[model samples]
Target: MSRQRLEHYLEQMTLDEKIAQLLQLAAPFYDEVGDEGQITGPMESLGITVETVHNVGSVLGVSGAEKVISVQQSHMKNNKHGIPLLFMADIVHGYKTIFPIPLAMGCSWDIKLAERSAEIAAREAAVSGIHVTFAPMADLVRDPRWGRVMESTGEDPYLNSLFARAMVRGFQGSDLKNDKERVASCVKHFAAYGLAEGGRDYNTVDLSERQLREYYLPAYKAALDEGAELIMTSFNTIDGIPASGNRRLMRDLLRGEWGFEGVTISDWAAIKEMIPHGVAEDEREAALKAIIAGVDIDMMTSSYVHYLAQLVADGIVDEALIDEAVMRVLQLKEKLGLFEEPLRGADVVAEREIIYCEEHRKVAKELALKSCVLLKNNDVLPLNKNQKVAVIGPFALSGDILGNWSWNGSTELTKNLAESMKVISPSNIIIAEGCSIDKITEPQIHEAIKVALKADILVLALGESSEMSGEASSRSNIKLPEAQLQLVQFMKQLDKPMVVVLFNGRPLDLHGVYEEANAVLEAWFPGSEGGVAVAELLYGAANPSGRLSMSFPYAVGQIPVYYNHFNTGRPKPSEDTTEKYVTHYLDIPNAPLLPFGYGLSYTSFTYKDLVLSSNEINETDSLQIKVKITNEGKLSGVETVQLYIRDVSGEVVRPMKELKAFRKVELAPGQSREITFEITEEHLRYYHSDFSFTSDSGRFELFVGPNSRDTMNAAFRLKK
Candidate 1:
């Protein structure tokens, strides 16, 4: 249908029908076989009529082509207009063939891989009758204690924004109106959801608008810039106002300032929670505030369904607001081509044939390999295929490697490390579960040691469970569980070579684990094909190329440690001998155990010849910078060349270094390549003290190398 047709349909809607278009409900509300009381329990509790259910704009958490076909057929039978309901779900990582979690995908530092993963996910989800996926969560998370960090791309704004754009392009392809395998992307947790207080989930956020614009808001804007069709309001309060009803945030900033005409939906029941947030007196007030604040859809809430029509009637809310909100919903449905074909891509035959097929599984396996970060390697990796290997730990034989937010994925399809190792070293492998994840007895350790004594090498597979690091699963202490550490302590006494493979969600304080093991691989819950990928890396079939996207702190006290932190007035002492009156730690080093972008490969790379085209340049002229990189080892590898910049002086305090651009290049043994980056004036623009985008005339320092810490540097000037 055309825009004019959609507008005509919108004009014909009654006040109740228009208000219902701004409400979303769960699958149970429209279940055909469920009991009447069970189906309507949520409605009765929220005081919504059954009529509102039949007219709802969309449905959440429902899938399957048959069921969606039934619901759409039932709703169209009761409604005067033939508008189809949009189906949305939390297809965060994947629908069936689960890929690595978002954080792990960030570690890959390959934008094309990230885009391909989302493309595959969209294809799988569309066949199952899902129209929009609340995914590509572009929150910039520096604090690992916020369990939702698992769903975000890492700490860097530039990297997160890149991933955000790629994910959006992948989900909503250029031809969304005609694409049958695509779904609309929804970038979520609008306005600083990652900066929750004390790194707690749903906690308050208080930051200057400049700080908010500079750091937290760019990723969402990047997604919107890529034409993301929807935005979900965060659950947290921003500067004493909840994001769901913050007019300045949603109306003035998102719509007026950013020109984002996409439909804005509330995060799961966030609009109704405004009552508990002490901002609204009741559900009626909540609905009034959210509608006035420009929230288009109330997810899983009756506040809008029950009171929005009455608010328009009483003049508490303008009727034009309802028209605008309903128009956006109708526009989205038209773009989705729902009116022409109500069951847009709902084909039962396609769902069965494409759900977890071989092609999707292949991409999942490659992503699992690319996502695994080799944090430390001491020539002990690339173990001989014939070596007598021992796989021992809590996760050695467990299939719990599929991480959080994998709603449609199953662990039953996942192979354990021992099961995968059997293919490479069939008769010489010994496997034992050293202990349970959280606890271990002496007998279990003895059995593990006996198995370890028989093998020449040990692969200790361990880390947090999938339930330990997502949504309300925050941890006060970001360390390995005691049982795994104790098991490590026992294994350290052995003289055999040890390799520690971690399956976790967040960056862990792995100082002790690194000390005990000769080699460590930070494999953050590598989905269904994780076991095979680990085995391939172990036997030299695939090179280890993944890098760390988030910094691993030395201790829990350094919770918010990141590479892009601002320089302090009294800088931390570089040397331990002069620690007095400085920001140095008395017990540990001030640096992270492993810095951001820090990862080891089977081969080594050397950086040299940092060059700048000019010593100074005007604001309009592009500055050229180049560096030489050489693969000095015998194995072929992929190198992620990172470029960082620092302003010598600025209107506000500047970070030590901020990542500007990165390139991933493949190099053969003894191969050398020269990479160049152009710095435009736009790259230098940052939010000033007055919250205006401007650049100050100053000297600039540039660094280029493998990671953040160890780099080759040069100096240049930016003139007015």
Candidate 2:
């Protein structure tokens, strides 16, 4: 029988069978590690049985093609409906081949690399039994305090949009149903979940409708356009409704208006937590709300399996809702070719041998190098081989180089910064554990201070752990934790040259580092080969070109900082000192430590003469903006050419500027290129006051820059 006919026949079975089809259980990853190194704990002992799994439609965390096939054979051996279960994994960066964490990939700003990484992840995952990935988060985030910024691209909707599309295409490939290596792409957190209040994880998100459509919605829509097969609801609510239970966000905006013909899944255990969200009175109400809102999969929440069928029978939810969800899941399975020989691509030995393969490592290294943002360089970097380098801080020798959220990476397997630097220049490198991360005791501060007096240079590796900034990880103070600040101050007292290599998961207030360290590298948890990558860049083996996709704040008090924030009528410039009756804090300036799109390299470049192809254009026409960039330094280097546009006037006031396009350009010394970025009416479109997307007849300003703050401007007009 055809897969469609089988799906139809299954739909005709008892409501019990339909409920079984929508249920998915957590599956354990086959690779075993010691208790401390495992990414997640076992779900096997949670009263899970083959009978329960047989009643489920999908399984997550299960891999190894042999294991997948074995499980399939078991399902066929006992599953009453005889349905094949789909396997999913995080598979964010790469399956087992450690790549630069997603934030590091953001620094590369290369869609092709993102796509290549995803393709490789798919290839490895497919070898085992994985068919779906909860990746390419595509959430437009600017708050560095929110730890998952490491998983997203960055603040700008445009760059984030491109990254999102690339990731979806990479995961899904050209055709998903027929390609074994290609898994279904799940575009996540459907709406404005990124704007969590106070940069807190799972916090309330309240955004204006224009802010919602103009910034957040585009990336998800772009990912969907690129054929994302699943959508995951965010942990937060839009307004007062948790996204999992909101009909407007899930059913209306996503499926009804956007036409996303895919299964909507809740974030792990979200469906059951609707009671805590105060949206539902009980688990039964939560199940009804989520299903009615078009959520198909419950993730780890067994609430759907326990209460959904009864909800339908009680008339709280329609049987049609069940059918709608079942159809989407079946269609996706058919797309994956699961109906015809479910184990078609299953090759357990090949999967085990190939996962985390070497070539993926090479790509990961290249990406890691690209993601290292040079925040500050005062002619102190490009270290001379003759100079003795004093590497100070707990992060120096602690091979806990694996960034946060690495499920299975251990310090034993991970390379420490000291080791990678030793590989670079063994004899010249000195070491001292300045202090532990948040270690208030400062037992070794004297040793670090002593090393500082003798060494010609220093590399201070200090930052938070992988777990310090994800999921429930929210910080009230995002400064260098504890003695780290005191150590930097102590090192500064030595009057020697130093570079602070920060291995943090979030953007931190590096005011102390900026004052003391000669150079600063914001290495936001470069994964696996991070040590090697940072060492190479520090030694001038690789020119530091990674730019800050998110803004760095001066303090956690300046939370929710970004480049495109709406300009207030009483706009306070950096120099504005009128403390009386202004939208300004009496003590602090309304500016971040490092503006968005800010990153520095060894060599300097200058942008001159902003020119447009034409001053005016219609909605369909393209306006070309060009700038001549000179590599005004001795060393050859790369520059990320950024293009930002502003709506001078709108029905609703727009932000000062919005990032439209950017490109990473490599130039030899004395070489100049007039790079032209094409701007279209499509780029001009923004959500209007009435919730309609339209481009208006208005004067627009084009801003070109090394970073958002360092910019040159010109004007153009777009007509109806």
Candidate 3:
């Protein structure tokens, strides 16, 4: 059906049916029904009442296409108007063909691949009868301690923009109306949830307009530009108002300013949490505030379902507001092609065939390998096949492979790194669980040291699990969990050369390991194929190319560290320097353990001679900058050539440097490549007071290199 036809169909629905369409119901874990039906979980549960069949607006926590179809059909069976329910799930990464989490994919710096991954996710999700995916979390993070940062694309607006647009395209496809299985992308956490207070999950966000526009908000606009059909508001508040009930954010900026035509959704129980935010007296008041603020759907919240109509009856909320929100909700269901064939999408054969296909695994492996950044290597990496390797860590044997926000991740069929290595090279592998990820005993340390003594090579797997650091799992200190670090220290006592394989969700402090490990590979929470990918990189099957998207702080006390930090009038030059009255810390440095865009490879690549074709430009002029890179080592490698531009001064205090453009290039040993970056006027524009974007002419600096810290700089000037 056309958008016109869908709109007409929605207009024809009755008020009760419209209200039913607006409600999103809660269900238990999916998998109760056989093929050919939408399996609403309550049908098989013990406490289900007759009201469940009639009053359920939608179903949550569902799976399988046929089961969803059965559940939706069941929902319509007892309804007066037979309105089919919207089936929602946390399809954060992927549906069945699970891709890498957004952070790891962000590390890849390959927008096309990210887009393709989403495309496959959308295809698999849609085929399974899922209408929407709560994905492309576009929130920007400066604090790596925030566990949910793992869910975001990364800290840079430019990188987030590309990934957000790609994910939106992947989920929505070319058109949702014609594509039977095309799922709508939901832009999440409406505003800056990334700068959560002290890096705690679901904490408050406090940001100035200058910071909000310059740092956050851009990726959201980009997703909106790409036609994201739904949006999930953050639990975090902007200023003092919770995002779910913040009318200025949801209504003013999102709806009016950005002109987003889609429905706005509350994160799970976020509307109810407004009471905790102190904005609402109770759940009833929370419902009133949220609907008044223009929220269209309440996910897993009884706030809207239990009290929205009551709020209308009490005149606390205008009926027109309900109509407007209900309209958007019904309109989105229409966009999902639900109106034309409400009960026809569930396909058992598609579900059976699509989940965990070889192609998906190949893509998963590619993304996994691409995400493994060689942070440091001293000619000890790319292990020889003949070497005897000892793999140590609790995670190596545990079923804790997947990172955060994984909907259905399991290690049931997965080969842990130790097992995977044996498959690739049978005779040279040894497995030993040295220490737990958390607290460890002295005997564990003794065992680890013993393993190192007998081994020619060691691969230490260390990082957080899928559960330890996401959503409710924020950590104050984002170092490797204590026990494992002690094990690393113990292993360092031995003379055997070792490699540190990090499987973390956030940028962790590897300060101590800088001197201890011979080689370090950042294998950020790679999904199912994580082990296989790590094995390949360790054995020289794949070269490490991924780079850090967020800066790893030296300590959590240096919370909001990044490469684009502003220069204080009296900026501290170095950590060694003392502070009399200047901005310098006595114990810790202001700098991160590693800067953003930081990554290393076994093969050394050198960047030289920054070049710019035009320094002065207008809205119409294009600035071209080039940098020469040579692969100085004896292997083929890939490099992400980053171009950063800094505006000396502006109408607003600008970041020290903003990522202008970056391109990933492939080069063989002894080969040279010149990468050019096109800087348009839009790249220089900043959101001014009154929200109008304007640029100022000034002397600017251009830098290009392996990472933000390792760059060669030059100057250019902008003209009026």
Candidate 2 residue spans exceeding 4 A from truth: 1-3, 8-12, 28-50, 440-443, 573-579
Best by lDDT: 1
How much is the lDDT of residue 135 in candidate 1?
87
Candidate 1 residue pairs in clash (backbone atoms < 3 Å): none
lDDT of 3 at 710: 76
Tens-digit lDDT track of model 3 for 28-141: 623453343344455433233344335445566676776677776765666655556777677877765566778989999988888888887777776777777888899998
Return whichever of 2 and 3 wins on lDDT: 2
RMSD of each: 1.7, 3.4, 2.7
* Per-residue C-alpha lDDT of model 2 across residues 101-172, encoded as one tens digit per residue: 777777777889888888887887788778898887888887877888878888888888898999999889
Writing each residue's lDDT as its tens digit, candidate 1 over 1-720 gives 677888888888898898898889887776662322223436775577877776889999888888887777777766678878999999888998898999999999989988999999999999989999998899999898888898998999999999999999889899877998999999998989999988888889888898899999999999999999999999999889999999999999999999999999999899999999999999999988898899999998888878887887787888999999999999899889888888888899999999999998899899989989998888899989889999999888888888889878888888888899899889988988998899999899999999999999999998999999999888888889999999898998997899999999999888669988999998898887888998898888899889889999888788789999988878985845665787777887888888999988999999998889998888789988889889999999999999999988999999989999998988999999999999988888899988889888989899898999999999888899
Best by TM-score: 1
Each candidate's number of clashing pairs is 0, 5, 11
Each prediction's Cα lDDT score? 0.89, 0.81, 0.79
Better of 1 and 2 by lDDT: 1
Root-mean-square deviation of candidate 3? 2.7
How many clashing residue pairs, candidate 1?
0
Q: TM-scores across all candidates?
A: 0.98, 0.94, 0.94
